[model samples]
Target: MQMLDGDVVLILGGGSGLGLGVARHFISEGASVAIFEVSQTKLDALKAELGPDVLLFKGDVTSVDDLTACRQAIVDRWGRLTSLVGSQGIFDGQVPLRDVPVERVSSLFDELFHVNVLGYLLACRVFLDLLEASDGSVVLTSSVAAYAADGGGLMYTASKGAVLSAVRQLAIEFAPRVRVNGVAPGAIADSQLQGPKALGLDGVKQSDIPKEAMQEGFKRLALMPTLPTPLDYAPVYAFLASRHNKVVTGQTVLLEQGSLNRHMLSSAGVSGGIGTPLG
Candidate 1:
């Protein structure tokens, strides 16, 4: 039997990139999926690609009304909600504090926090009742930036850190009724991750970054040489959202490809199987 059979899932920002990938994975696992996205164009594209098995709605993550309406639509169609996935986020182009213009600082901070931090909070809040009724789970999309520097700029990093904190707190508060967890992926290649309009980066996407440049950066920092795709990280969210996973909660799984520990050990020098210890 499929892992998520009979499950009803709601994914915010599920039109493209990791969100889109998660939606597809859930559907394949026998879950009925509903997506809340701000882009009509992306929603239309996803509808055409995934067919009617996937429900699509257009809404901004920052709007409580949009979230409420989306939830109602899901309940009206699916009868109940079994899981909630928060996958909406924006990047900061790794613009350091020194480079950030003072004039743009406040707006940039607000824009990124609204989508990255506030968006997750609002999603959880709006879905609380449905999730409680079903004893469902929440899987939030965090980033390597949540725990490390250089993963993103100041604003982006701070916002993701807040996500980690929320996962822990919410887990404690909602215990025995709902599970809250997170997945922190790192340096995805060809991601549709966008940036803040306040910084004139709304049109900019991670896919626009040169592949060679991203590879070089990853090679220098990551112990694992392979750069992951959004599809590669989808199953983690699927596992977390599954009803079978009852023990794990209040945790943020690090999907950083060993980048977190690269500082202490070098994968570059190691080759072949484990050899005799050197004296």
Candidate 2:
């Protein structure tokens, strides 16, 4: 049987991008999946694509009522939830802190935090009981930005860092019952992630970067030399969400494809690994 067999998962932001990809993979692994998405368009499209197998709900993750209603729906249908995969987030357009107008700082921070950070928190909160009851898990999406610099601009980095921290704390709180962990992916290929509305960049997508150009950039700097698709990441999330993940909790797995494995000066081929075979 597949690892996720007999599991029931609720994916926040599962209408498109990474969430959507994970939902599909989970289903193929024999798990029943439901997705909470804010986009009616994505949800409608999913109804046609995912058919009757996956439950689709339209709601913002930042709102308690929205999440509570979705939690009820999951309970009504699946009877229990095995895991919650948080894949909802927005980028900050990589705008430097100094460049951002002082007047918009508060708005920008609130908007980013509300979705990227609070959304994850609210989902975990609303589903806490189900997860505990089922001995389930929580797998969240963080980013390499949380550990190192330049993964995103100031606001985005801070938000993802917050996610990393939450995974640690929530894991402790939910210990011996539900596992809480996270994945910090880098340069997701074909990602549809957009920018923050407060920065007037909500329409801007990371895919706007030319695919070949982006791939080339990753190849040059990353040890893996290949940008990872959501599919590439599905197994990690699957394993962590599954009951098989007994030893891990309160940990955010750094999934940067060995890009950060080298010293800071190594990306330019300045030579940092092994150090000439250590003399």
Candidate 3:
């Protein structure tokens, strides 16, 4: 239906993983897409895959100057931006607080928060005026970790929780002009999600985890029989970024396939009664 037709959308970390999925969805819906990514390799890859129609900007999400330059470039090309998507983040490899060395904790926290939380804040700040002018929306990539434990370790969980809070507060603060929302997806099987350099997991990707372990993890945590692919969750971002979503603001949609329902059932019997009616 081309819900985002004639819109100019800016996405942070849009070169790969969930961000790339969202960018593809936006483009399919007829929006002009701009991506800000730190990896030149990913940028080149996306340019090749998505074709020259998509604007690819090489920049670190944590850097204000980089974000500003990207925003400026978008303005110069597209004249105005209609939506901002913050999808940049780092995972913590589910390392428990006790397992982390005390000496590395400080650096680990800073590195994770800078990319996951502060990066979103900086993107919103840099694009505030443009968003307000366009009466646009902001969609931040949160996670199941934001609301529950075991989705990640202390560092990742806390950072995403902060993202949830920021979505609400920013929605209120930008009310009647710009809308703010978030999507909290769980256990995406194909994500290029990585961990903090401080914890020596900078090169880790979700696909690197053993298939059986990943499947078992999702089975234990989610009521759904299988985990979702990154593409499965992209539509939510596109909907939130659309101008037709006029009344939804300050809400983070949970895309975890009923993972929260796991708390009510025993792990051994989880999903056994999925199709049964509640009596």
Top TM-score model = 2
RMSD of each candidate? Answer: 3.0, 2.4, 3.4
lDDT of 1 at 49: 87
lDDT of 2 by residue, 43-107 (tens): 88889888998888999999999999998998899789999999999989999999999999999
User: Clash pairs of candidate 1?
Assistant: none
Looking at model 3, residue 270 earns an lDDT score of 75
Q: Give the per-residue lDDT digits (tens) of candidate 1, residues 1-279.
A: 999999999999899889988888888999999999999999888877888878899999999999999988997898899999999999998888888889999999999999998999998999999999999999998898989988889999999999999999999998989999999999888899897898788999988989999898778777786889888999999989998897899999999887677663334575543878666
CA-RMSD of model 2: 2.4
Segments in model 3 whose C-alpha atoms lie over 4 Å from true places: 263-279
lDDT of 3: 0.89
Model 3, residue pairs in steric clash: none
Off by over 4 Å in 1: 263-279
lDDT ranking, best first: 2, 1, 3
Lowest summed lDDT over 10 consecutive residues: which window, candidate 3? 264-273
lDDT at position 19, candidate 2: 83
Best by lDDT: 2
